[model samples]
Target: MELTERQKRIIQIVKENEPISADNIAKHLYLSKPTLRTDLTILTMTGILDARPKVGYFFAGQNFEPLLFEDLYEKSISEIMVPPVVIKKEATINDAVTMLFMHDVGTLYVTENQVLLGIISRKDLLRSTISNTSINKVPVAMIMTRMPNVVTLQEDERILDAGYKIIQHQIDSLPVISKDNPALVIGKVSKTVVLKHFIDEAMHLKK
Candidate 1:
């Protein structure tokens, strides 16, 4: 089970100011005492928190991120991968820049008919635009890190693989592809997306 945002906040409150009564926590969030009590019960029973006589709550365990990362290790990337933001191979660097802003993606795949071709990142576009005079006339093919050099993920891989690749390649995003057809781009995953999903899982619903 995962902890809700309010529940996490409650945990933080306890961590910051230990031995606080439940009423204080409830008042802080403007929640009723009984409602906060219910959450307290759930958290304590789950071993995420502990209580004592005359005292309130305290963090029971340590190294929460490792546990969260372990959970993320079991999850498939497909669960959180976003649809690949792609641009055509023939499009201009300016065109890629425009799409990058429109999609708000760190990286863009240059493709045709969903078939992977090349990739361009914000860094690549920025480098080219700043140095080149006719960026708009320059095809993305000229600036993109072409295939064979791109690091990609398949549907069979877990988010762990994506996370590893993100760190290993030191890139912002990984292009996700079909297991059956490695060239067929399916989606994309970033460290932010993976971490967000994992955090949500850790701090989930109360019930």
Candidate 2:
């Protein structure tokens, strides 16, 4: 449901003057009523404007947002990212496993203080357990994908760019870092989260 410039202007006009007739609306736009007939009909059909026999039209207050392609995918990372599940670099492998399950996340951001050090995934923990390592004593630092090697996203990057990076790197999640300091982890964006955003937006548009 993308709205044309004229359609948008029509909505604004109706909002300012409720129960305004097509003639007045056309007057506001300085156009003939016949020229605005299709726009008015489409607006009413989409529930954006209400029509009446005697009362010209009123803003319907429904579907106010325009669902353009850019509006859907050009949102910044800060708009959709979730808090990163963080664990200290010195935390034991067992502790990492606990954090992952506790948060129900696919990846955990490893940090020292507030600075991101690395990231550990479920596969890392599984491999450690299979190797007969002492999960309780072994530090997560031993297995985490270290910084400078880990792929990260900036907080201000577009969602479209985020999706592309995720697929290109074949990673499940990206640690969103601060633009001021690359080592500072601010949030996280995952494959699941991105998919959910698109799905939710699509469902909203259908409504």
Candidate 3:
């Protein structure tokens, strides 16, 4: 597809000062937010840019070095991970709701014997509620997504691979599984982490 002049200008803006907000681009270019949104959507669809919710847009298509940032981002999953708020297989749905609120995480991993059993997401809870099911009485396992179906990544994998998985799976995050125990989860790789690396690499390249 041929790039429009405005789209090219927007690409330059993101390339020059990425991890930059669309609203900021609108302001600097003196264009309305809707106009900028149209441009961003086109640029992103064309593979010249990538957008992250709450983070903004960044340039894509750059070659990257995983080893270079290994020391910076390759810490053991235990080091960088926010402790997963988990639910026992036998826990009540009410307990799942409470954990979600307590941790402010959209999904909760369900485990048995410290092994990942399944996952319960906000959507799962909502579906239960919408059906007028009694959360206090229903076990989380009843509504949770089962394992083997759950998508996961390992901490030892390069962050670039994690990013590729997210894009390929069309998932918001990937549970980081322990190498020693695939059933044991260590952390998560969300779009935020992916965009951070993309922005950091682009900035470094520009310098």
- In the range 85-190, model 3's lDDT, one tens digit per residue, is 6779999988888888987778888987678888888888988878856888989889988989998877677654664566566676677889888988877766
lDDT sort, best first: 2, 1, 3
Model 3 CA deviation exceeding 4 Å by range: 1-80, 193-207
Model 1 residue 47 distance off true place after TM-score fit, in angstroms: 11
Q: How displaced is residue 44 in candidate 2, in Å?
A: 28
Residues 57-152 of candidate 2 have per-residue lDDT tens digits of 998888755544455567899999999999988899999998889989989999986799999988888998899568999999999999888999
Worst lDDT window (10 residues) for model 2?
Answer: 64-73
What is candidate 1's lDDT per residue for 4-119, written digit by digit as tens?
A: 79988988988888877888888888988866765676566446778887887788874345455346565687888988888998899889999999988899999999999989
lDDT of 2 at 31: 100
Question: What's the lDDT for all of these models?
Answer: 0.81, 0.85, 0.72
Candidate 3 at 14: error in angstroms? 12
Give candidate 1's error at residue 26 in angstroms: 41
Quote model 1's TM-score: 0.67
Q: Candidate 1 vs candidate 2: which has greater lDDT?
A: 2
Query: For candidate 2, what's the RMSD?
Result: 13.8
